[model samples]
Target: MESEKYNADLSRFHGMIENLPCGFFIAQAQKPYRLLYANDEMLRLFDCRDLRDFCRYIEQDVRNIVAVNDRERVEREIGHDLQAKSDRFEHVRSHLFTRESRIRYADISGRLVGTEEFGPVFYCTLQEIDIPQPGQMVDRDIRDYVVGHLDEAIANQWIQVYYQPVIRTLTGELCGMEALARWVDPHVGFLSPAAFIPVLEQVRLIYRLDSFVLEEACRIMRQRMDEGLPITPVSVNLSRYDFDLMDVCQVLEQTRQKYSLPRDFLHVEITESALAQDSAVMHQTIDRLREEGYEVWLDDFGSGYSSLNILKDYNIDLIKLDMGFLRTFTDASRSIVTAVITMAKELGIKTLAEGVETKEHADFLASIGCGRQQGYFYGKPQPIGGTLAHIESEGRGIEPRKWCHYYDVASMFIRQTDRACALFDRYGDGHVHCLYANKTYGEQVHELGYQLQDIEEDLGRPETAEVVRTFWAYVDRSRKSGQMETYFYIDGGDYVNTALQVVCEMNQHLLIYVEIQNLSQSNAGRRQSKLDENLRYLYTMFEDVYLVHI
Candidate 1:
């Protein structure tokens, strides 16, 4: 009796769906998605004569009904929505292929359902909308054109790669460049990246575009090398689809190797939004990229609410400050940018400011110790051919400094402190050059009855000779052990404590950070008395007391 009622209920459900005005169908939940049933409206929407014709046109698979360009995105979105939401219903918009191979814009809604015969399936509704084209091309038209002509665009060189310079704030030299894609169609003239990039992303064809840009950038780098022109790292942006669709790290590595370029020559930039999607995969990809010697930068950082979370979860080499921070250019924005740069420095990550269009913006970013800057203030994005011509006319090209990274890192460290701190480059010849010193360092030197200029310029003064020698000795030990600290007496019976830390060593020169603290005057008398007592006790304890002098 129950079996008969189940059959009757199924029959009633089929009848109700067949009479509905809109298109309705049932499909398997899994891949190859066998189409179990389709209403007459669904057959008409697909331009099919009947149910058998519809099934045959779609190859008995619901997935076949979606246009090739939109299939992956539609499937991914539906699957993700089904897993993430408690509600059984999910909606997605995609372009579907009709029986006559015509593209139709569709709004699809599906609800998960269980049946005795099909086990688990999706009961889906499809609606087709005819979008009108205006004098200017609408988004639907652009998407259609891109979907059909993207491959042709790439092949015919309609897709062009352009580069914008990234300058080191301190040196005002080109430290890097960011590769950007531009579309120039013969039929449509020039198309804004805003118009095409998002469309490509929606259709999940962004990985191909990004790969094209990277390949073009590599070719440019090789050309520059062949011409003996100066070359710096060129950063290439990667879309999230790149990671989802292919082995992103493998692609990058293969491209770098193909051009015989250094791993650092091509930097990987992933936007914050991209990183937030499928963080597990992103984390693994980032790790693999870095492990292969590619510097992975978080592009458009601070553009989203999960910025801090991304920093916490992934190991990033640098962060590109979102241009939104500088768009309005308010005091509040300044404070926020400053705080972000400081925080990144403290976390041992570099920062680059974007949209630095004005002198005020550039000056402010430099004042705040932003490591890098990229904007129209430096140069606009241009093709490689144009860039080389401009450089030739200007008689110089952007060159990378080997020690700039170390210098910038040390400068940021010294600037953030209120203590007497300075950065020094120690040479093998027992001489040191001051790279940078904080205001507190100069004030402390003045308080010690010494001129800051004299201390930095010449340590050969009678009063400073011994101190300099001792400091160099500490520097040497720090180079071997990473850090060293000592307390010593200065000329005015003032005790001072000093620390030496090695930041990096390159070309036989060590970058060291030094901090000095002047002890309180009130403790001098007590310290002197204690020192005399200890000296006397040591002399008495040891029959032969040897003193080592510097």
Candidate 2:
């Protein structure tokens, strides 16, 4: 009698489930996922003719219900959700495959239940959903699509890495490249970063995208090297979420090592706003990247409120001036940019101006001493192949000569000092080139009754020939002895105290730092004191200062 009552109660329960409005089913938890039961609504949802057809359509396996493209992700997500909750229930959104080979977006909710017949099974309910049209898609729609299709997009080459050339301002040579991501989605057409990046961040999937970009950049670099093409450092942008989601430094190091590329070949760029969040992770990431020989550039600088604060707190190698300054080119804007470049130079941080569309903008930036530039005026972002072809045609793909570093180092020192300082380069032609002169150096030249232009135009002029020879002699002595040398000479009856130090020497190329002190009416004691002070300062800066008695 008790058995009959139990059977009657079970039948009633099944009948009620079969009439439920939504689809309901039960399947084994383990692989091969044999379906134990499916209600009438469930059969209809899959467009099956009957129970037999439903069984055949899904191969009697619950896993087959999900579209093959989405099966792995759905399973992984469901597993994660179930493991994270003590209730053993999970809710996921995925694509389902119907009997007619149609794809349906679905909302699935399931619970893990144990039964005597099946060790463990999922009692699930699924509801078909309508995806909004691209024109009407909201954030949620975009989010779902991105999350579902990101892997596919990466696998299918829908995501392409574009390179924008970074040019050295002084020489207009290609100094580096910035790797930017451009997505050409097959389903929705071209998706700008504005369309998908924020969605990815909100869904915590940005790290995957960033990692993909890093890998692509490394591959391009390796390919370029293999082809015997000149390559400059390629910078990959990292979102703030990257630090929170994964070990950013480890990923970068691994990617670089995987290609056997030098650390300098790949650079890292983080937005100014990202750094403004100011977390310990961000600080550590910057420090570690720099320590590992990678240059860390602060991208989109001045876009955020804490630009100066970030500069003070973080050790950034370069600052990419925001494009907004160029968009609204005005006297006020120019002044602001000039101040920023000057400040950055003084802080020993290099500056690059972006959005340079006109020659006027480029010329202004170069005049203000911005070290690098990137804009349509130079070259728009292009795919690796396009970039290579453009570079080849323009004949600007060659790497900067090793002697450039000498000028860079000397410029850094000269910019930091208020005293008159200049960089002099002498090649095999024996012509001394005043490669750079700071404002103070130019002013000092004027005070000595010689035009700065004249000196720079012809350092070999008869008027300055004697002094130039003396300066070269000191430079040679400093080079041969590997020590700093000083000389005092009279030019136009003015007592000029000078210090000549060889900054760098490569074969016939010699880079010298010239510090000029005009002690025209000063006494012997004053001249000696000034020279001592200059030597002390040089020693403090470079730790290699020696006074040689002639």
Candidate 3:
């Protein structure tokens, strides 16, 4: 009873630490700075997976996460604090890497805390300093400073463009990049976008900034091409105000023509929220742009007001799923994502999932069929010079992890099945969450990815809902009976003959396997001709959805 009580107390202690808002860490007061303990937020902030992973990484060196130049200074200061047994250390600006290996800046504070048993330890809290502090208003002086330097900065090359790479999910090939804006003020050092962009936008000077980025991005790509380097398409984001201020197409077309670049070389990305303004003009602009051989992507999708109506009406070439969409792993979120991918596939749209940090996120996305992705897993944004240097240097071998524990069954089957197949975990509801998918099914479903639970999405459409319902019912019954079931459904006039099998793994967990094949064109055509008659035949053919008892 005493031991049980102690264990319960310890569990509560862990819970409290995990719930802390700010990142907290405890490190030994010695060389190599061995990590003793860290809160969940600390792991999250440093982009460490867990305590075991974090300990494995440092191998007794705090410099593993610190910036190269800052390492010596950081170590010296910490050593001083430890030697003197300082009660507390004031805020110190520090550079660190997120679990995704993205570079970030933070204001760190450390306090020397210890007991006889531990000897000495440093407790630290990290507060990221790059973002604006809550309730801290932007000062007028900074605004005026920006306004005063705007013209000179433009002419003297203070504004810079950085390229963040986007890779093909399956092959890890460098497929494209996004052009981001940066400002380097000689007096103030590197000014973040959060600092200068609002000032620019307030003065309606954002167009000038966007134009510079577009031109410079094109020039950089052109230079790389001239150097005999293969260059992929680069996307430049345009503000809603940018579209209103100038002929966006004209600006892009002129830049392309001046560089003699191919039409597909440059891409445009517009935010989903921006779609609400001046719909008619925006529609016409997008239509004209597409006709002129340019691709327009919907940026930051599923962040705000993600209306299916916008997707249905717009002529968008691609949709970039926002990181927030996958921030929380839940059944509902998965279901929604599944539906979104399903609809996007039917509409012939491509998807690129952003903010993919972990191998789990990447594998899940690839299994769903969304193979175009970008995130810290690939690499962080770098200046044009850095990007070029990186390209010239050795390849960073950033590839999607081929296997995952959660989706082990699906991963195993994908390697062997030529036919499209998906592995699902029965959730004991009318729903089953897809765990893995074969490449054939994954790629065929959509260029981006689809969710397995998206089977529920078909229930909404009166056209395909009934057929899907029958299919699920068959699956559900067969799973319960510990057996196999076969069913069929029509996808875009193609008859997908499907077979479902259930297996009990060593863990005593049940896995449902879905195998699918697209019937030959002749067979599909013949089925299409007898669609009405076949609909009647489908119900009777199932014969009350009988299961083949294994």
Highest TM-score scorer = 1
Task: Encode model 2's per-residue lDDT on 374-423: one tens digit a residue.
Answer: 87667667897787677667777444546446545544544435668877
TM-score-wise, the better of 2 and 3 is: 2
Best by lDDT: 2
lDDT of 2 at 397: 49
Candidate 2 vs 3: which has more lDDT: 2
RMSD of 1: 17.2
| Ranking of candidates on lDDT, top first | 2, 1, 3
Model 3 clash pairs are 47-99, 368-449, 368-450, 369-448, 369-449, 370-448, 370-449
How many clashes (backbone N, Cα, C below 3 Å) per candidate? 0, 0, 7
Tell me the tens digit of each residue's lDDT in model 1 across 1-550: 2222332354624333546667777777867678777777888768788777777787777888877766755664565456545435455766665676554566788878776676677878887655324333334466788888999999999999998878776556577889999776765545557657998999999999999999989988888789887788899999888888889988888888888998878789999998887468888989988998889999989888899988998999999996567667898888898889999988989888886666778877766678889876566578866765654564544655566556566546644456788777766664667766767878777888887667755543324576676766776687777755554544464556677788888767777877877763435545677764565577568755444549
List candidate 1 stretches off by more than 4 Å.
Answer: 1-140, 326-332, 385-405, 408-415, 427-432, 442-453, 459-464, 488-497, 517-550
| TM-score, candidate number 1 | 0.63
> Residue by residue across 1-550, what tens digits does model 3's lDDT show?
2222322343322223444578776666666566656666767666666666665666545556565555654554454344344467655555665555455566677877664544666667777655435443333356787888887887888877899888765445566789998776555445557657878888888898899999998998789779976677899988877877889889989999999998877889988988856377788888999999998999888777655767877889888886556667677776676566656766767778887766667777776667478875565578866764564463643322222222323323333335777766654333445556677766556532344446535533325666666666776677677777877665555555678877544343456777766653445546666663565467558756332447
- The TM-score of candidate 2 is 0.61
Cα lDDT of model 2 overall?
A: 0.75
Error of 1 at 312 (Å): 2.3
